[model samples]
Target: VTSMHSLLQSATFLPQLGHNPLASGPLVLTKDGHIRGVSGDKAHIFYGIPYADPPVGAYRWKAPRALSPWPGVYDASFPRAACMQACAGPIIEECPQTVSEDCLHLNIFVPLEVNFSTPLLSSLPVLVWIHGGDFIAGSASKPLYDGRFISNFTRTVVVNLEYRLVVIILLSFSAVNKSSDM
Candidate 1:
């Protein structure tokens, strides 16, 4: 079985021949499901793809569960909410106003030249960027993290991912410790 990490790591060269002519964006079929991403001048941008189930309710304070294959084409043209966090200050406009537990999403930027003709083992390198936030704040949806220019200029696939932070991490550790005492 292909691990999710490897699947995403190699997603750069996936065939892009599944475009829906009636849709406004490009379509890419992943193991999880079909996703529609916007087409940019230099890259194809897929945003807010869920890598795992929402870390809410009973799932809270526990490890994230793998996402099952979704039934339909997921609209990945727009960014999703960032994981719950506080804005650093007034000038941090990139901080998303919406925050939720269901924020374990990732964004992918693929160069325009990488098409169906490209082999799955294409020579292009993949860059996986995990945001730095002192374990308290940060989001993959930040405009500064957009990978279009990097993907286009470097001729590579770029991926950015969002993860739980601060309170969530603390709660998780506390839960684990308490459970271990049982």
Candidate 2:
């Protein structure tokens, strides 16, 4: 029989650290299906988790709604497309090459030591970082937004969330305001 310690050390053992773990190891089942994240020595990172359905097509210009579940174990190891925005900076390069309307994603970093046996109230506090973009453009994928170093140092869980930018969301609000003025 595999020793418990060895099993714990196994890549598949989740120890119920956070969310629901699937049987495939390093894989979690959220409200959606199985999601595979990356495991670091200090923390387990889940990236590009969708909180809402893609704000495209008929959903465009509408408030966010529940996210539709995906079919398979979604690979969440990489960041998704940043919210739609014009390219800036010296190079003036657009991120992801293809911006999408469905860019509502979040990245979560959890300390490796966090486990179910730990008291819920005593568990490490979670810090959520909302990157500043002047309400326009920024992404959780940016280097300045990385949560790994701080999470390791503080032994705290860190979350980075992405949302629609000013161009997309503000335009809709302005239209509504104009209509209301009439």
Q: Estimate each model's TM-score.
A: 0.85, 0.73
For candidate 1, the lDDT comes to 0.79
lDDT per residue for candidate 2 within 38-67, as digits (tens), equals: 777667777887777777886787788776
For all candidates in order, the CA lDDT equals: 0.79, 0.67
lDDT of 1 by residue, 1-182 (tens): 23357458546545534667688887878877888889898788899988887889988877788887889999999999889876667646756688899998889888877764335454668899888877678888887888999999998889998889896888778887889555
Off by over 4 Å in 1: 1-3, 88-94, 116-121, 176-181
The RMSD of every model to the true structure, in order and in angstroms, is 2.8, 8.8
Clashing residue pairs, candidate 1?
none
Ten contiguous residues with the weakest lDDT in model 1: 1-10
Off by over 4 Å in 2: 1-25, 89-98, 114-122, 174-182
